[model samples]
Target: MFTLAIVGRPNVGKSTLFNRLVGKRLALVDDQPGVTRDLREGAARLGDLKFTVIDTAGLEEATDDSLQGRMRRLTERAVDMADAALFVIDARMGVTPSDQIFADILRRKGHPVLLAANKAEGRAGEAGMFEAYGLGLGDVIGLSAEHGEGMADLAAALRPLIEAKPEDPEEEAEADVEIDEDDLGEEADWAPTVRRPLKIAVVGRPNAGKSTLINQIIGDDRLLTGPEAGITRDSIALNFEWGGVPTRLFDTAGMRKRAKITEKLEKLSVSDGLRAVKFAEVIVILLDTDIPFEQQDLRIADLAEREGRAVVVAVNKWDLEENRQEKLAMLKEQFERLLPQLRGAPLVTVSAKTGRGMDRLQEAILRAHATWNRRIPTAALNRWLMGMLEQHPPPAPQGKRIKMRYITQVKTRPPGFVVMCSHPDLVPESYSRYLVNGLRVDFDMPGTPIRLHLRGQSDANPYKNKKRAEPSRLRKHLSGRKPD
Candidate 1:
C-alpha cells in the first residue's frame, strides 16, 4: 500500500487530518501544541482509494537531545519511510517562518510533496491560502480537515500518485483466489481464513519503560523514549509479527494518581490508555524494578483484571539489578499478596534496554491468551462442580440448604460460567471465591479472569401469575348431581 506521512509544525491539525482520513479517532487531538509525540499509522481511505497514512509528531527546530528534538527526529524518520509527504500548513494563522524552514527541509529530502492548506473553510483563511503558494512546493490544495471540505480535490491529486505504483503479483493472485467448501478439511471449520492479531496493551505508571519495552519487542525505534516521564501522550497501537504470531502492541501514556494529574493533556493521555486496556485481549503491566509494584501499578493491574483482560506482570530493568534472586523472590511474594485476583499470572523479569528475557515474556503472553480463551465441556464442568460441592458445600443460610445444582460454561474469552441453583442470591461471596479458585486449579486456567454468574430456576408454570377461571353454576350443579 502507498504510505503518506502528514508533516507540519505544532498544532497545525495534522492529527485531525489523519483521523479524518482514517475514519477513526486513533490519535489524540488537543488544542495544545505537540500533543502528538510519536508516529501513528492507520489504514486511511479517501473515496475509493485506500492507503496507509502516518500521523507524525510536530516538527521542531530543536537539534539537541531535548524532548522536542527527539520528536523532530522521529518525524523525519517517518518522512524517510513514507512514499510521499503531505506537508500541512495552518491557513488560519498564515504561513509562518517555521513553515518556510520545514518546507526547505522537505525539499532537501527529495520525496513527493503534497501541500495542504488546512483549515481553509472560511474567508478568513483565504489570505493564508494565497500566502501558501509562495513556499513554491507545488499548487496548494485548500481543504478543511475538520469540516471535510476540499477532500475531493485532495483525493484527485493523490489518485494519480497512488495509482502510478504497480500492484504486487502475489497480493493480486491471493485476492483473486476463491475457496471451495468441498475441498476444506475438518480442521478448516474451526480455523479462521485470516488469523486475527492478538491485541496486547503495555501499561504502568510514569517512566516505567513501556515505550522502551515495545521498541525492543518490535526491534525498531518506533516509539519516542527517553528519561522523561509521560513522554508518550497517546495510546499508540502498532501491528507486527512476534514469534510467528501476528500481534498488535499498544504503547500507552503513563498513568499517575488522579490528584497528580493536573494538566488537561495528561488526563486525556491517561483516559486514552484506559480505553486501550478495555480493548486489549491481553494486558502486559510493565514495572520498574527500582520501584516495582507501587500503588499505581497495583491499580493498573487490578483495572486490567476487572476489565477481564488476561494479565501479565513484567518487571523491567533487570539488567541493572544485582540481587536478581532475592529481588525475584520478593517480587513473587509481593505479587501474590498484593494482587491475588491475578493469582498465578506470569511474572516475567525483562530488560527492555538490552532485550533480555523477551522470549519468556512472549511465551507467558501466549499462554495467558490461551487460558483467557479456554473453554470446558458441560459434562466436565458439572463433574467438577460435583466434586467441589462434595468437598466443601455451600453454607446453610437462615436454616435453608442452598443446593448447588450444576455449572455450565456459557462463553470463553475470560471463560464465563453460569451456575443454576435453588437460591443463587443466598450464595456467599466466600463460596464463590472457592469455586473460582477451584476452576483456576482444576481447569488449569491461571492469570485469566473467571466470571461466575449464579442463576436461579424460574417458575415451571408460565401462567402462575394469572387469575384462575371461575366455575360456571351449571357445571357446579352437574357435579353435585353426579355425586348424589
Candidate 2:
C-alpha cells in the first residue's frame, strides 16, 4: 500500500484529516496545540484508493536538543519513510512563517507533496486559502476535514499518486482467495493458520523509559525521548516482528496519581494509556529500578490484572544498579508481597538504555500471552474440582453445606470458569481464592487473571420460581367429589 505522511505546524487539523481518511477516531483530537507528540499509523481508505497514513508530530522551528526539536526530528523521519507527504495548513489562520519553513524542508527531501488547506468550509477561510499559494508548494486543495467537505477534490488529487505505485503481488493473491462461511461460526474450534501480531502495551509511571524501551526494541529512535518526564503524550503503537513473532507494541504516556494529574492534557494522556492496556493482549508494567513498586506502580499492575490482561513486570535501568543480585532479590520479594494478584507473572530486569535482558523480556511476554489464551477441557476441570473438594471441603454456613456439584471452563483469554453449587451466595471469598489458586497451579496458568463464578442450582432451573396451578375439577372428582 502507498504510505502518506501528514505534516505541518501545530493545530493545523493534521490528525483530524488522518482520522477522516482512516474512518475512525484513532488519534486524539483537542484544541490544544502539539497534542500529538508521536507518530501514529493507520490503514486509510479514500474512495477506491487504500493506503497507510501516518499522523506525525507538529513540525516545530526548534533545531537544537529541546523537546520541540526532538519532535521536529521525529516528524522529518516519518517524511523520509513515507512515499509522499501531505502538507496541511490552517486555512482560517493563513500560511505562517513556520509553515513556509517546513514546506522548504519537504521540498529539499524531494518527496511528492500534497498541499491541503484544512478548515476551508466557508467564506471565512477563502482569503487564507488564497494566501496559501504564496508558500510555492503546488496547487492548494481546500478541504474541511472536520465537516467532511471537499473530499471529492482531495480524492481526485490523491488518486493519481496512489495508483502510480506498483501493487504488491502477495496482496493481490491474498485478495483473490475466497473465505468460507462455515469456518466462521461461533462453535467452530478455529485457529488462524497465519500468525497475527500480538498487541503489547508498555505502561508505568512517567520517566520509566517506556518510549526508550520501544525505540530500543525497534532499533530506531522513532519516538521522541529525552530526560524530560511525560514527553510522550500519546499512546503510540508500532508494528514490528520480534523473535520471529509479529507484534504491535504500544508506547503510552506516564500515569501519575489522580490528584497530581491536574492538567487536562495529562489526564487525556493517562486515559489514552489505559485504553491501550485494555486493547493489548499482553501488558508490560515497566518500572524504574531506583523507585520500584511505588503506589502508582502497584495501581497500574492491579489495573492490568483487573482488566484481565496478561501482565509482565519489567524492572528497568538495571545497568545503574550496582547491587544487581541483592536488588533483584528485593524486587522479587516486593513484587510478590505488593501485587499478589499477579503472583506468578514474569518479573524481568532490563536496561532499556543499554538493551540488556531484552531476550528474557520478549520470552516472558510471549509466555504470558500464551497463558492468557490457555484453555482446559471440561472433564479435566471437573476432576480437578473433585480433588480440591476431597482435600478441603467447602465450609458449611448456618448449618447448610454448600455443595459444589461441578466445574467447567466457560471461556479463555484469562480463563473464566463456572462452578455449579447448592448455595453460591453463602460461599466465602477466601474459598473462591483457594479454587482460583488451585486452578492456576494445577492448570499451569500463571499471572493471567482467572475469573471463577459460582452458580446455585436455582440459577440453572428457570421454573423454580413459577407458581403451581390449582388442582383441576376432574382430579377432585376422581378423589371423591370435593366442593368448591
lDDT for each residue of candidate 1 in 353-395, tens digit (9 for 90 to 100):
9999999999999999999999899999999999999999899
Kindly provide the TM-score of model 1 when superposed on the true structure, using C-alpha atoms.
0.91
TM-score of each: 0.91, 0.91
Best by TM-score: 1
- The candidate scoring highest on lDDT is 1
User: How displaced is residue 464 in candidate 1, in Å?
Assistant: 11
Worst 10 residues of 1 by lDDT: 182-191
Summarize candidate 2's per-residue lDDT along 244-315 as a digit string, tens digits: 787778899999999999988888888888988887899999999999999999999999999899999999
Model 2, runs deviating above 4 Å? 176-193, 458-484
